[model samples]
Target: MASQNRVDLDGNPIKPITICMIGAGGFIGSHLCEKLMAETPHKVLALDVYNDKIKHLLEPDSLPWADRIQFHRLNIKNDSRLESLVRMADLTINLAAICTPADYNTRPLDTIYSNFIDAIPVVKYCSGNNKRLIHFSTCEVYGKTIGSFLPKDSPLRQDPAYYVLSEDASPCIFGPIEKQRWSYACAKQLIERLIYAEGAENGMDFTIVRPFNWIGPRMDFIPGIDGPSEGVPRVLACFSNNLLRHEPLKLVDGGQSQRTFIYIKDAIEAVLLMIENPARANGHIFNVGNPNNEVTVKQLAEMMTKVYAKVSGEPLLETPTIDISSEEFYGVGYDDSDKRIPDMTIINKQLGWNPKTSLWDLLESTLTYQHRTYAEAVKQATSKPAAS
Candidate 1:
């Protein structure tokens, strides 16, 4: 309701712009779609292979902004309609990709194709059509931090210069070809290069977003419930499923790897700023994440255990998590970033944006959604299948 009086940073009334949102049914996309419909007058040409996540927004025509939103059910990989959709909109936001870590090593080919190859035509379409493009790259593109290579006891590791990922300054270091965990990161890096090349040679207007661990409700599916039984989503959903099923969270490599998480709602605000402030955003790569909410994977698991107990009235597990080697958990060729703390200089300077939610507060809200939405279903699923 407060969005009725929206204005740009320069005190200019924000004009509604149609966006061709590729992968508009994923975690980030669903939230963005919700924000746009509720808060802004913009139109979304929602594109994705699936629409289960955004189903509420697409149907019945009773909800507001129904006319302003359309679902294309388009796959950028082989879809013939990608170009036309990009050309029709004022901006094309490509969020389509295979981002989960499980598939990176097990399904490297699909990972590469989805993350990089599939994105080529989308980039080309936007460039050729002269449509402004906002490509959703990942913090995974940063791969690993410099401090990760140093001795564990090295005091130099404390220096922010060694670890803080900066959009303009940080080096993109990834594991070797064998450590196929880098497949997604490598693919994303290549695409980022290609996008930069497009901007340099073809003069494409673009903004690249590198999001740190943004987690909240409707993030990912719980395996054997809404998603495949063997599906492994990011850390949040992974731990949520374990908690809901009364099982221990699986920690890989002692869960020592550190990460920073921002509330998805907070992160979406940064994206909206990028969407409206093209003058400030274009030709820049923004790292949108909360450096203040840093924690180890083990710490995250422990925190979630307590949070779920509070939300669902369930008792916390005595041993909330079980540690396993990277080889056993992720299989061979899997590696992880030691840390991911975004240095917010670029995004702050460009969009005047900053993430606000604390980790514990974000997790509390997220677990409440998880318990309400999936706890009953998880109970039924884990029940012995009705004795056949």
Candidate 2:
């Protein structure tokens, strides 16, 4: 659709605007950039240290939207260029953070600094310059459900009111300080509070997005191929790597933790609505996820195993998954959220947005892409002679 034909929720025609998208090379950022370029007429000043994931969109100046998207190679942490970038754009979207679960406990200090301290300047710049800000927070900020504290045999644990995470109602619960896994959540919560305060005190136009496990192609890198051989990515990439190598997916702590995943394409639609309709989105925290797509990690593993077999035409392994303790997988001081089902009332009432993809359907398409993109590389890598 052309920009002229685009209409806001209130039936107002949308105007083209430049967006300063920090961390535009990351998974969510890449998808947002693609959406903005392909579906909307907005220009993006894409800032990130690396552009490998978005390289497809950046090159070949002859591309239709070439002039609309420009990549700036700079880190937001200390770059003198950040403030000017924010001032030049009509809106700013901050997506930079150390978000992987592996880093939350193992690199707690870095996680805290990246999620909170580094983001302070972005919030400050947006507030000071009167630029609208869209900050991407995590569902991890909800920590654990209240029902998780109930007795295992308690019937109340089955109630959705006790377990469902609400943007406006739920409490942010975290484990003891020794459990460094909450570092990321703590930092994010603090930053969220700061942003909220800025809005309440200074009337800054802002929207906070809490994503619940948005997964799809071009997510985190596959180990030993694009990322470090020892690097541990999020669950999707982790399982995808295991499947590509024909190895058993390692389920951490019996994989009892439950998660709700929304397909990236579906989640991006909600974001676009938030972007184009600031009247409905400003001063709101939206939980963008598919609540109906909830699954236990073990269940997710099994589904992925089945889907990968179908996509790659490979036989299913007799033992598709192996259980590993949290200490062995994520190191010491690790904790996990028992369940995360976002209360969709706020987002639905405000933006009228809902996720549409099913878990199995998303997994089928995602696994197919994974197998096509990496199976050959994995085969050659494993077939190589060991260095003597």
Candidate 3:
């Protein structure tokens, strides 16, 4: 029997169990699934728009409790499909949305409606089922508090939602609303409001997680402001690929924007921790990230170059100043965050959860993964030619 706003744990009320992740195929989602499957005894369901392209990411065999998790092909926009999935789940974590800056910029309409509008049914389903809902929110919502050293409680500063955003930060501000793409933040803020309202009025358990700049494997760290097809232009991925090809790392816009990057594993762990403690998480918001480890773009490029040198057995090539001519979302010469860090005081003390993965450890693991994968790919390609 279901209680007022909480679902009973495993037919009992002690250790609440059972969870369904909406976008389990994504980077953070995949990591979260793996973490949950290993640590918890709960029945986990991983849902996504199953496609051949991302099949490896969704493979149940990759998780510890492969038999426990059920993957379903889903498009949140579809009402019936969403309703059916939401009905069977005890707890729901909606990580389905266009999360990246490139995505928000290129597909603004899809980002806005699919996240804010289409997800209405999912939230309603959680409320109706008396199950807990964990909605994924980005730190990008804390738009440009650049070098401002503003805490979570600071007055909301006006900036594009696709940039340095926070969870508690406001979506609306006084300015030429058209100048910046406030639509993305506006949409998320609207959904947050909607969920909060439902949680209060309908007695539903809902939690919001706002993650800061997170980096790791499976992250499409490519160049260009558009989607994946554009190219590998991101400093990290680009540097890794360059090392593979024995090329010099290219620094764009002098690589000055500093950002706090949370390791993929740590980020996923925080999500699972929140899910397990639904009672504490209900109707509460937490900033999930490591605020201490902040690195600038130039520092990132240098670090990648150093990592590449270790694997490639080659000296670091002299990086040259490359002019970014592309007129995409992260336009040319556009100054990004000087230092965007989070204050994890609340999450750490209350939840007793802190990011364990260090920056060096994270970067080394990333470099190693890229190195091994690239080597395997090259070996396969070259060996095939010889066999023929």
Candidate 4:
């Protein structure tokens, strides 16, 4: 759906295409839906179990793009409507999965089933229907960096070759089965292999994306406000919850793990390129991340504390963070990924995409959203008297 207002790099009008966006109510999917509707003439068959995140786009038929977006409330695990939905669209995007890290160790069986087994039919339908598929994987599939195995004082740890993760070259290193933390990574790796094999033998047109900590607003939820009181969300939401409640952010294992985060909007531009130009995206596994924004978890905590204080007009707590062992924080059989920095060769060459937002700027914008969206709700939830 190329409009008069938008065109490809070659100055050609892009055709509008109907997209079957599975998991279309999650953080990434919601943003993608908004972008497509506001900018292009394309239509979306939005499928997901929950639609709260995207309700703003769905309600009030008076909205300009109301007809372009339709929501399907169903689960992929047992729904009979998934195949028909895929049949209706020219493209299918599989984003349905249990992606939280807290579930990896404690709920390994559900994790494996959600990440791997549940995705089998989605891949088969695409392969059988000859439809283009864009599947979302994770950076955890890269596991720990190569430098993690070297001695603590080794000089080669500074070399990028030893740590930077590449799509075609880096080995997928995982811990022992008993560690259990690798359950999510292992499941995701198997799904990637299956997708690659589908393209190899079945001539399926497919693309796999490995996201490295893409962050921004409407990500996950604030515990006890929009989500379960006992739920442990991804790091961004976890830290935001702590800030909103004026509680200390908890760090696991001294917060030594390092990661790079890209703004959700920046990453969405790459997806749009892929949607508009299948010639540049098919049969390739691209690493979508911002390597320039790398930081250790401890450094991230300090930065978040400062940014939250600045955004919320509140003083930082005397103890903004507390350190706990992984065993205590994540429970037994826990493990960690040492470092993750993506090699951007494939994505840059294919889509000409790059992440533009700096860490501080992105955090400021995100925390501002958090403060505005959850601060009052959290206060009300906390002020209530305890039930007997």
Give a tens-digit lDDT track for model 2, residues 1-388. Answer: 4455878999999999999999999999999998998888899999999999899999899888999999999988889999999999999999999999999999999999999999999999999999999999999999999999999999999999999999999999999999999999999999999999999999999999999999999999999998999999999999999999989999999999999999999999999999999999999999999999999999999999998899899999789999999999999999999999999999999989888999999999999999889999999999999999
Q: For each candidate, what TM-score against the reference?
A: 0.98, 0.99, 0.78, 0.98
lDDT of each candidate versus the true structure: 0.92, 0.95, 0.65, 0.93
- Superposed model 2: Cα runs more than 4 Å off: 1-3
What's the CA error at residue 229 for candidate 3, in Å?
4.1
| Candidate 3 local lDDT, 269-375, one digit each (tens) | 77766776666667777887787677876677777777666765667767622434223425422323344667676677556788888777888888877776565
Worst 10 residues of 1 by lDDT: 1-10
Q: Candidate 1: where are CA atoms >4 Å away? A: 1-5, 386-388
* lDDT tens digits by residue: candidate 1, 49-147: 899999999888987788999999766777788888888999999999999898999999999999999999989999999989999999998888999
Name the top TM-score candidate: 2
- TM-score of structure candidate 3: 0.78
- Top-scoring candidate (lDDT): 2
Q: After TM-score superposition, what is the CA distance of residue 148 in candidate 1 from its true location, in Å? A: 1.7
Candidate 4 achieves a global lDDT of 0.93
Better of 2 and 4 by TM-score: 2
Q: Which stretches of candidate 4 lie over 4 Å from their true place?
A: none
